[model samples]
Target: MSRAPLLHASPDQIAAAARRVMARCDELARVTATSGRIERVYLSPEHARVNRLAAEWMRELGMRTWQDAAGNQVGRLEPAGSSRIDQRAGGHRGPALLLGSHLDTVLDAGRYDGIVGVLMALEIVRLLRMPDAASERWTSGLPFAIEIVAFSDEEGTRFGKALLGSSAVAGTWEPAWWDLTDADGTTLHRAFLEFGLDPGRIGEAARRPDEIVAYLEAHIEQGPELDRAAEPLAVVSSIASARRFQLVVEGEARHAGGTPYDMRRDALLGASEAALAVERICAAEHHIIGTVGRFEAFPGAVNVIPGEVRFSLDLRGEFDGERDRVWGSLSQELDAIMGRRGLRWRSREVHAAPAVFCAPLLQDVLRAGITQTLPSRREEPPVIFSRAGHDGMALGAIADVGMLFLRNPDGVSHHPDEAVSAGDVAHGIRALAESVLHLAAEPAR
Candidate 1:
């Protein structure tokens, strides 16, 4: 007649579990491409190794595990002991709620970029499977199924295209991408074959909108905001829109001894000024960032004035219109600077991605999870925008998506120096676990 009270893990147990996740992250980091450093890219041997390890762990938790056509490691847990593969009329089984992040790493990556998210998802599943945590309100089993996916490619460091793994699952993969080549001259198609995957079957990875109840990802903040606020966890509002370009400045080469400073048309000087202009313009606008991350001069001779210079521009903002607006203004400044310096310049668009906003309903669910898990905190959890791209950007196409960000004490990522305290990871795990429980109790939307 009455509902049984919900069970929650103690703070001490949550902290110990968090340490396990962190230690597992370090263990997986060891399975990388390079011997001493982390460089596990898409479809590489190290990628395969990590997937195998994750699959084994998934099976240990009573979930069926398999590798999807897109090279993602997938694990599915049906409601407790029920064996129905799909839901039947008047049955308790339902569409799954997805939780996970990519396992692939960038060059010399830290132990907890994407790795921590997948581990946290696994921990959530572990909590769900425990007898004490299970709820009896659903009659036979939990209302919805639980699925964990460790995407194979999110960094795109090998193929120069991000979200390949998620795109496939979202049914947004482009056939033309198969022809893309890596630095080693291997085509994506060829690499797929080498990795024992059939590229032609990638479409099979796609899931219909109804197949998933929702998607949630746990990731590091990858910025200083959370660290500065002294908070261990936060909710993501939206991922920033980003555009990249290559700029080339052309000018006549001249001898350093013969050319006067005022008379010489130096491409390097023009490019350098353009880079400064980008910073100055972006600084004027809030939440806009423009970075000239790469630059090079032709001939590179100390005695000769540069004939040509190439540089990269990466612009990002909280909204698409704002990002584009900043780019337009920055371009005009670059045009004026090049013209005044008597140099010709051109820019080629390399990549572009629109921002993805988290679903408001899911945001409320995660917020409740954070609140219930960290009742000691007086203020509401900080909602921040992600300046970096993630697999969620692609997953957003097929399902409503939300994100939880853990604090990075050093605010560093993609390097060995990147770090997250075990205490924070414990908070992340508890929050994620609570989020799942909260979602399980809700009616299907």
Candidate 2:
């Protein structure tokens, strides 16, 4: 079937669409686990609420919707006269272009992190389904169908393992994850059961490698780069590689007043020096970041010396080798600091994910879309690498992946102050919709 030409929305219409998205985001923000902050984790009642809301919106646009076994909210608008089975049988050439981002968020997350992407997708569907100037449904039978997925567990706040939802769809879910537990000591297995999901049927959520044409995600630029440059949108080049560790420092506990300064083996001091080493080392390298976000010193009494210290480290970089090399340097620094303080330390890796690059074809399409949307710009849209993890990392294993970034003021994210302007969101919607049309116009592989 031949694809229909895209029907571009007017400036006023685009603004109105953006307003609807913002309103929906605000509406979803109210459906949080915490009383005063946003905290919607995987398989919680909040997840189920948002999934129902998403399904309702999808149905309003004449799309078919369902919740996958992995708890992902899914919607599909098929090519006119085509069925899901027909699209699946087409293998790698399947007539489906997947668009979406996660719905789950970290504890105390901002409203737009993943919420904006999913809502923007719904607006795109609405725009596509609109009657053209001639009052005809020209876009009803595009060559490829559109599928939007609201992933259930990208934050890993509940189970301590990120990408659980997308990993299932990507066919990369590990059986060992079933044994993972939450803060309440509920195993993932039990959570699934309590959530009305059958663990054995979880595999049903995995889509065949050949079943999707490509995966595209829209997200906020969780950094200051775009805001500093005064750009509204950018094409994402790749997601960063990352490693996380839980580290412990051991020393002898003693009375604070009795221990002489020269005889002290302060574990807290050693851990503090290690955190500084991470900052010093990572700052010297390009696109490398290391953070010690968690810290604790054993023994509650202020009059006693801290005997043990525990901390968390999160390291990320554009390249895996560079990141790992920096880790080695940081490790050596930790050893020196501990040895000098007469303390010992060890680490357990909590998470690791290699960088994932966007497909060149998708990148080109994004650039073209940006150029078309911002016709006055003589230069190409900026391309950036994401420092934060995303659902794209999991989907990259099964299908070509791409991302578009909307600017957030001051680059603040994972916090309540995280924000995006209505003007910027309007531009993002246009660019993303144009990108979909550009991809549709490409010849079938």
Candidate 3:
């Protein structure tokens, strides 16, 4: 006798809705890529256009949706029996579910990184609002409400400050956080104000205590594990811990020809050696993941030895202890490389987030739903780690959070070539609907 998401929704209706969503992903991929990082999103201009479009579409969904001072778009679903917005969310008396993801992509992002969740939420509401015939005669009076958000920042591709929007809602945003700046001296607070968002209203974005009983976010599994497992949709049990840092290597600039191997201290060469050592150290310690994704070398002359080099180091794992251990090994390798190469090296920690564990109740519901949607895919569920981060990480600080990941086959994201199978996209939609229904049906407080 539990109220649930409208499980009565027919397969045909589900398919149609999913198809529409998949198509939108394709469309947005094109549109979002154009703005190309307007605010540090992989495609700035595209991110802006997509954000505006999402807000417009949310309004069209018959829900009063608006953007907050932090630029996080918001939409509300009132209780079935009520016509007015409930102002008692902080009291945690009312029941509601939150669903969403980011709109920004990494530099040269593909179509499906954070955009899928926004599209899925829109479709779910679309089906729920349709009349029986159009809605496939499905309805649920589960006293449930859904809150959709397209978080403005997650990748921190612009100013290297990821997960800003989600962190703001979790009551963690601060002036110091806003003080962060990018390479060009673009302050985060200034960026917010320039975009017409207010830093002063940051407190208004905080979600109330237990106001949201459940949070579900859908995203592409940005890893090779799922692809290797032959599974697409994964009910994430936990998110791996991550530590990011930038290493700066300094050496004397001199004529490449003049700086003979016997006397030269090539900073770029030292940094490259350190990068491999970092990867090797991870392998030596166990299953740690490491990447030296960004690197820049100074002194452009073809014959000149580079004077300085900087690179980004990202290390992640299924547990925190392992992450820390890998960091220690990386430090050792960096020091060893600098000493042996006679180069000066230094590093600074950029960000840190612990692994997140999913709610057992909700995870089981998700696993069941994935099995039902694609029977063969049940035990074959995708078990993977998110290389790229999301706002869900910030939400983890305040409450239990879970994510449903669809297949990212080219296994690529945050790039122009990222793609998800239409069939896999359908599986994702079915899984979300099923999970939502099951969770809503339960009378758990």
Candidate 4:
């Protein structure tokens, strides 16, 4: 690791750059599936459009840009001393520092959730090489190259599988996933074909563990802790362990008017009781959260008793063991609730990702960067745990990961009202740039 001298940009410059990042996010927000809101999903035309626009920006920074086999838009900046284009060559350049987040958004998505991370990375490079001649000069002085990625799918809104793009890069793509389908019943394979991607070539997207020096992600704090602290940013300690399940409850359908209250076997009623149990159980546990975000009832007519109910459970905790314990309790609660209601219940987990801890060395660099960029009074930055899952989880499979969380005043995310302040964005950009320089200076591990 080379410990390079720290770099700083004036507050004015940072503010200007921050405005640019915001403007770009606003521009990309317009490229969505819905005319009135943001809804870019994997393999959608809007996804293609956003990639084109982001690629144009990457080109402007003089980075070699390409769409990886998995549909991620990637940009590479080689070190100034190296002329090699391929990192896998026998004459391979040193492992590049990885930067980025997913570009795809959830339904009615917020503009900054993942978009800001990619733009901030671009801005970091932009700030570092502000002098046109210095771009190459700075590149040559670095020990390793830099790579920016705008991952294609992290939301899983369209295909029901999160981290598809990052998982490919992590070499964790499952062959079984090819059979997964979207709302229109379009399989991932068919979607790849329609999007001009060859499903067979997905293996080409994988990056060896040695290919990345470290992964750094700058994302908004999807929760309200930072806002309550009145801080713009903090270093992430870990990503919460998470599990998602589709729960079903079944009972006999009957005429609502004819069914006696004492003899009722209502699936919807049982599910409603189970939902409360989830909330009640999770509420008592520290740092544990459970949400029933989606719900549906069969035989929905007002005159008919619901025969079946399906609901989604998203449970998360700071630790996997704790999370699993909560799941066990919730399962028992559901079983008891079903028994009392004389209904049948079942659950199928759709997703499970363990907690990922940020690399300590990288965390130190991030902390230093924050101090150097923000000129904080404190030597150590507040380290917050992310309850929300990120592309970092997938990337963690291949490389050490670090993260910086920018404050979202209301801590609201995954909704249309999601927002961030320009000042906080400026702080985030400067901190990210500083972290890169800190990394550039470290000796090879």
Tell me how many clashing residue pairs each candidate has. 0, 0, 22, 11
**After superposition on all CA atoms, how large is the RMSD of candidate 3?**
3.5
For candidate 4, the per-residue lDDT at 269 reads 90
Please report the candidate that would top lDDT against the real structure: 4
- What candidate 3 gets wrong by more than 4 Å, as runs, is 1-6, 33-48, 83-95, 130-138, 376-382
lDDT at 259 for candidate 3? 66
Sort every candidate by TM-score, greatest first.
Answer: 4, 2, 1, 3
> For model 2, where is the 10-residue window of minimal lDDT?
84-93
The lDDT, on a scale of 0 to 1, for candidate 4 is 0.89
Runs with alpha carbons beyond 4 Å of true place in candidate 4:
1-5, 87-92, 133-140
Pairs that clash in candidate 1: none
**Residue by residue across 1-445, what tens digits does model 3's lDDT show?**
3223335567787878778888887777666433643223622455567777887777677655666656777776665665555444222235568888888766666767788888988887676665542321125554667778888888887777778888878888867777888667878777777776677877878886467777788888886667776777888877778889988999878988766798898899999999888778887765578999899999857888988999999888878998897788788878888899899998899888888777777787777667667765325455455655677788887777888888777577666767777777777887887777777666667
How well does candidate 2 match the true structure in TM-score terms? 0.95
Error of 2 at 295 (Å): 0.7
TM-score (C-alpha, index-matched) for candidate 4 = 0.96
Query: Which 10-residue window in model 1 sums to the lowest lDDT?
Result: 131-140
How much does each candidate deviate from the true structure in C-alpha RMSD?
3.7, 3.0, 3.5, 2.1
Error of 1 at 158 (Å): 0.9
Among these predicted structures, which one has the highest TM-score? 4
TM-score, every prediction: 0.93, 0.95, 0.89, 0.96
Model 1 per-residue lDDT at 71? 95
